[model samples]
Target: MVSIEMIVAARARLRGHARRTPLLSSPFLDEIAGRRLFIKAECLQHTGSFKFRGGWSAVSALEPEVRARGVIAFSSGNHAQGVALAARLHGVPSVIIMPDDAPKLKISNTRALGAEVVLYDRAKEDRDAIGARLSEERRLTLIKPFDEPQVIAGQGTTGLEIAEQAEEEGVSSAEVLAPCGGGGLTSGIALALEARTPGFRVRPCEPEGFDDTTRSLASGRIERNATLSGSICDAIITPQPGNITFPILKRLAGPGIVVTDEEALRAMALAFTRLKIVVEPGGAVALAAALFHGEQLQEDAAIVVTSGGNVDDEMFARALALRG
Candidate 1:
């Protein structure tokens, strides 16, 4: 289990590095849910996602000699960009392995950050195998997206900030919801909330098709989806939850909630129109949960962490049309 002291230390370490993203009250959401809604806009975070916080924290904690050897990662999008940018900042070479079907915009942006890109077909090739081979051959440090303790500690910073902001606004006992991919962000958020606000519930919201966390929690063990079917929320399509994250989530997060792709699209459009923020479908899952499944959450202020804002232009426009 992650400790509160570690979360506090992470916040201190990431103070100047990660943006202190705004925690704003959304009247539109409040009206719909009949309760106050506070959004932690991590979509505005550096590299357009909260993954940067963990990437930077992990790299910054490395020994000087290990840093010299450089780093490698496998990600669909946001984590790739996070590792790429964070490696560059630390004067280390970085390489990212991504599924061939990952967003072109994200791939291009990661390359723009000077990271070498390796593409693999999700159907025919295993990205983790490729990453392992590359790590062994190149003597590179592997940064598993959500499995490492350091990464979880790094991600905990976002929750720490939310807790502080919630307290300042006099909102107690918020039901904090975050989208679950491999569970890094949700687990980290739960750690911070558990430590700071005793009674607050932390929930992991996921797309219905790719809800491994929900199943894992229900079965009281790790579960795997045999295959990942694409969703509008591409970012949370991990075939299985991480070994490290599942146990933490089982201990801390409330029953995982699954929302549909249509619900996610509606939440994305709502964020764009009402908040003037363009959030990726994956990032909007928390809000979707609030909108579509409010009855499941405790009737108090709910803090929805919008995790990223890296939607492609075409996808963004299409989501708007679908929602309309």
Candidate 2:
């Protein structure tokens, strides 16, 4: 289990490495949500996603000799780039296994960041098998996206920032919503808030078809999505809640919220026009839930973590078209 102590240590490791992203608000967005909405603009995070924190935590925590050997990760896009960049900064070799259909920008960016990129089919290929084989062959460390304790601790640092920022903003209580994939960020934030601000609860938000976390939380068990590749919000789509993250999420999180792809895209449009922040569809789901699913919430204010802004140009243009 991830504790506040571990999170503090991770923060220590990240002192100069991670950016303490801001908590932003707009009266216009507040009006739409019928509550004060604070946006934790992690879209502005390094590699344009919060994954960098986890990547850095995992890479930096490794034994120096082991780390020098290299690291490997499997991601759709954001995690790929996050791990790629973190490894580069640490002067370690990284091999990233990404789905072939991930955003072109993300694939290109990971390669550009100085990692070996390997592509695989999402539906047929087992990324775990491939990663295991690669790790064995190359003597590389595997940074499991959401399941590693150090990675969770790193992501929990985001919660620590939210707690401080909310205090600074005079927000004693608010629901913190984060886009959920395998539940790393949501569970991490939940654990952090559990210690820092009991009044602040974390909720996992997901795209409609890929609402496995939402369903799993309601049922008190892990739930699997029927398919993984159809959503426009690809970043948060996962086969199921992670084994390690589910227990934390089930223990600490509030009822999950589900949003549609259209809502995500509209939220993206709103972020661009109103907040002047570029948000990818997956990153916008939490804001989508905060704005469009208010009846499901009880808080007077909501803090939304826009997790990433790594959308492809064509998809971003589609979101921009929804601005009206």
- Per-model clash counts, in order, read 0, 0
Off by over 4 Å in 2: none
Task: Give me the displacement of residue 321 in model 2, in angstroms.
Answer: 1.1
- Per-residue lDDT over 105-192 for candidate 2, one digit per residue giving the tens place of the 0 to 100 score: 9999999999999999987999999999999999999999999999999999999999999999999999999999999899889989
Q: State the C-alpha lDDT per candidate.
A: 0.88, 0.94
RMSD of 1: 1.2
Q: Where in model 1 is the C-alpha error above 4 Å?
A: none
- lDDT per residue as tens, model 1, 1-324: 567787777777777788999987668878987788999999999999999998988888789899889999999999999989999988999999998889999999999998999999989997888999999999899988998877898899998888899999998778999999999999998888888886778899998878889999999988887678567788888878888888888888869889998888888888887888879999999999988899989757889999999999998887799855
- Please report, as a residue range, the 10-residue window in candidate 1 with the lowest summed lDDT: 1-10
**Whole-model lDDT, model 1:** 0.88
TM-score of each: 0.97, 0.99
Model 2 steric clash pairs: none
Q: Candidate 2 at residue 287, lDDT?
A: 98
* Maximum-lDDT candidate: 2
Top TM-score hit: 2
Cα lDDT of model 2 overall? 0.94
